[model samples]
Target: MELTLAQEKALNALVYFAERIKPLYLTKAIKLLYMADEQAIRDTGVPITWLDYKAWRFGPVPEDVYNKVKQVDNLQKLDAGDGVLYSLKVSDAPADLPEGLVLNPIRPFNDDEFSDYEIEILQKVIDRYGKLTSEQLVDILHQEGTLWHRVVQANNLKQQFELKSNRSDYIIEFTDLLDTDYKKAAFEVAYQSHLMQQNLM
Candidate 1:
């Protein structure tokens, strides 16, 4: 399958965190992207990336991102001495934003790998979330009132929710979780979690 714009952005984001915050695990990387897009959509009426996220057991994730991480050569295994860690593989590519996709309404600058505002938001997210473990991120996503919990509770989906790939895009029509108000509320939940984590750190 042709990769979606969000998947492309995911790799770019991986590269970014690798440079700015080394030794990030795969799951945390995904959560960071999800948090950015989710928050941007609520606050600005557009997401930093046009990725559609589902309420997965671990948290909200772009299906495209979940699949790509399994096989993409762009991610490398790090020798963290004991436990595993992941980082972006080397390429001279400029980390430019892909074309032919909708983007966040309020951005940092003119051209859009991400807007300046999106970058600012990302910086805040990464600084807060990046320091935590993957397990910690999962717990944060699972919190009540967050998008994942709301989706599961609304639909009565069981844990480890099983979904066929064919049914992926189909869920969009039934779920208004993407609506602005819900998105705003969802963003607040994650943002509050970020604040709480900051204090503990």
Candidate 2:
């Protein structure tokens, strides 16, 4: 949540401008502020995404100010290869955020929150599919009766498609589901049930 000096300056400028400008012109005002503080703005190196010269007319900011005010606005338009951009509004700023600076306000996936089964399944899917979309993998798993079964199947598919296809000696890599944690508590119940059926054996 620590903010760089440039972030602090930019945020303060935003706050100052927000107080005096008509609600419709806040976006334009921010851009102008950035222009006035060109060096500070440039230091951010975040590309402008949306240029709403008229957002303030609505009065009271939208809940998704960070997203609406992003240097890059339409996230869907960004190339997938581009690194993920983090964003946050002043209200959403973390307490630990430095004075004058706001956290970009993005959330990160917690790896520790994942269950062993989910990890195993996800890893298998990635290895096999190389880069299948999350939706595609989810659909495939849904068809397998149990979620774990779907994960196992997706994993199996990846192994068959990647390893087995490339090397005649390749064997399916089995996961010890009993020893692993699930990303969600629900996964544990499902995993244990699957194990009881000797499916994991």
Number of colliding residue pairs in each model: 4, 19
* Best model number under lDDT: 1
Residue 135 C-alpha lDDT in model 1: 76
With a 3 Å backbone cut-off (N, CA, C), the pairs that clash in candidate 1 are: 108-115, 108-116, 108-117, 109-116
**Cα lDDT for residue 92, candidate 2:** 28
What digit string (tens of lDDT, one per residue) describes model 2 on residues 137-194? 3344334443234333544544553544421222211122223343234344544653
Q: Per-residue lDDT of 113-167 in model 1, one digit per residue for the tens?
A: 5568877877878878878766788898888877676666777665235653322
Scored against the true structure, residue 50 in model 2 reaches a CA lDDT of 15
Task: For each candidate in turn, give its C-alpha RMSD to the true structure in angstroms.
Answer: 13.9, 23.0
Model 2 ranges with Cα > 4 A deviation: 24-26, 38-201
Model 1: CA > 4 A from native: 74-87, 90-112, 159-201
Residue range with the least summed lDDT across 10 consecutive positions in model 2: 51-60
